[model samples]
Target: MSFIAIDRVSIQPNRRPLNDQKVAELMQSIKANGLLNPITLDQNFNLVAGLHRLTACKLLGLEQIEYRIIAYQDVDHARLAEIDENLIRNELEALERAELWLERDQILERIGLRAQSGENQYTKKGGESISPPPKTTVQLAQEAGYNKRTYQLGKQIAKNIDPEVKEVIKKTPIAKSHSTLLKIARAGSKEREQAEQAEQKAQEAKHQQKQEEMETQAKLAAEARTKLKEKQLIALQSSTAQKQAKQSIRSARTQVEKKINTTPILPGAELGDEWILGRHLIYCGDTAEDKFIGLLPSNAALAIATLSFEWNHDYLIDEAHIVAVLAREGHIQDFCARHRMPFRFEWVLGELYVGIYSQDPILKPEKPVGIEGVEGIVAYLISLYTKHDNFILTPSLGHAEVLIACERMGRICFAGDKATENVDRAIARWQKWTGQEAKKEKHCYT
Candidate 1:
């Protein structure tokens, strides 16, 4: 072991984020008995392992730290070593493990340590080396203590899920679940493929550092990322698996919360009554009923409603700045004839017909957002019509997408339904997401 100045070690910028708890524990241990195992670094003084120990020493105000320097062929080789260290020593969360697995595969391929499909040690596939034999998925899976199928699925979960979604999920209970992640990754196949193609095109341009092509390449990359985001957004909203996965995550989080907080959280609100959840409000009663209507905030930003035979929410045009109704063209026309509000515009989103009505003529969207499902449509409507802290009114509690979207988007939702079961499910989902108990209002209209 050679002692080196703490400042001499350089760390990769995009390395796995540090776990504060781990660092703290290391600090306590090192403070008592000193660092027993030295960190590993490349010949160039780049960190390979013992990041937590190194960080703890730094936190303890140590100037020099013990390290072991090893030679490697290149950065990829060093990176492979670092990956091996993490995989062997650390108990990584499912998402973290999945990402490391994918990175390892890529690094192995880069260094000719990975075998391509349909090639064996005895066969020459592309004049590639097979002296020590190449590592396949089966081998890597074995190394990671997982079966081939489980490992491949883990890699797919890492590679396929939207990067943004992964970040949001990283700190949640869902990050620990491989099955839920697989379900989300499997949603919206067609859109996901398109997005992957776009991302691949953008990746191909990364190595082309030509000054002339730089500007053009940058634009292409941006466009590609935008398309990928769009596809993810669409899939996230419209896919059944996405909702189910989130529900599962919510359930898991709630259970975890239960263990920590001893005071049992009981329901405070019920059907034909209203209660506040975080900043939003929900009523377990008919939306058109005067009791529910009387509690409404006058300055709602947008109102979203589905097509119904008992449609009488046209007055929403007056209460909200924009009223959007989802129905077919003929149904919309029939409703337009009966409702007094001016039909401002109409747009087709995926398989749904959306009608826009306002007290005044509304400006058309510069670019219309297409939708393939309720989740997508609700997200789009929330984005297009509402701002932070704006009130969004929804008549139906169908899947709680509007409430979920509003909760995530910083909007206050005023939603109600005649079915108490639907209202109860919505409330439960919200409670799980926010980890706060819903209280029933004292006064109930019996």
Candidate 2:
């Protein structure tokens, strides 16, 4: 033991309970009878134990304190010594004691301080070293002045308690009681369960709301369809041939003749609803009649005509079917007059269907046949309309080829077929071009 400057003795990092009321009591005792035990320090003069004594000396305004310097193999050994000294000499809070015990246990294990079992070490030669068993929880608990069960419980509380609650426990003795901490832990679990239930109920409510909205929209749509069907029937019965349409066609023809006579070398094709003259106007029409028209075969033309109106109107053509075919040949006036069907136009990306009318037999153009001619027709008609401002509808299986052709030319084509094979092939072709899979569509016929 030797005297060391009071300022030279630094507190250990793991020291607990600084400036407790016990320090004043110690100071009083030292003033009366003087310090009986010297403070312990490591070679570096760091305080290892007797923190209260050191504090008392400082309070008494002592320039130096009596201390013993101990040599330690490592920091862990030093810490273990400090913890053991406090555990033996002073009463500590349950949490403080638990923390110290855990710290000491870890240090002892880390530094390989093991105890020999039974007489195993005695049987060894005098100079031989024997391995010892590790310290058990019971031993560590006992050293900390707690029974094994209380120590284990305290260990868990120290490990898992919230930081804010731990601070409260350290400051408030009542909060440090084991019962209080157990109650808080249980309450935390219940709170978490309530929060989860609330979130699940919110999700379920949102799903129910979405389902109701869809049902209401579906009902409104069904009512609208019914009203439109009733109106279409009334319109078809009162429809008659338009004398004005024949006059318009004749007037258009006269204009074409006049242009031909004036300019022997016409600069461009004359565009009509059915015919494209020079390289001029692209004529695309939709005559949803059964008559064979245009360059296609009668069967193919009729299929395409029926498909045009059917697909464009979303198979709402059942109403149109009930209305008689009000077109005929020779009476171009009456044929044109009958073109009073209210047509709704919307721009979409798809095929273009052209309409034609005739009295006797419709004249078939001597042009390319099948899909090739259809492609040519689409290309020509495309020149007549702005790309984004036009779309076509075809319901024939053969129209799939037309749709594909239009798509190839960078045109938006909407086409459907009663045949599943045609629909599948059309979807496949579109997917190939767009690199996007087409969703299955509901069809009127299928």
lDDT for each candidate structure: 0.75, 0.47
Highest-scoring model, lDDT = 1
lDDT of 2 by residue, 1-446 (tens): 68999998888655786756889899899999999999999988888888889989998999999999889867887888888887886577666766676567667767555333343423434334555545666776677777988877776655544445555456554334565443333333333344445455545655778666555555554454443333322221111111122233344335422112231221121111222111111123232332102222122111123322222322222322111121123433443354453333211113323443222232221121221134344433332221432333343435344454344444444343344444445444444443443332121111
lDDT (Cα) of model 1 = 0.75
Where is model 1 more than 4 Å wrong at Cα?
125-131, 195-225, 234-295, 298-309, 317-446
TM-score of each prediction: 0.59, 0.38
**Tens digit per residue, CA lDDT, model 1, 66-108:** 9998899798989989998999975788999999999999888
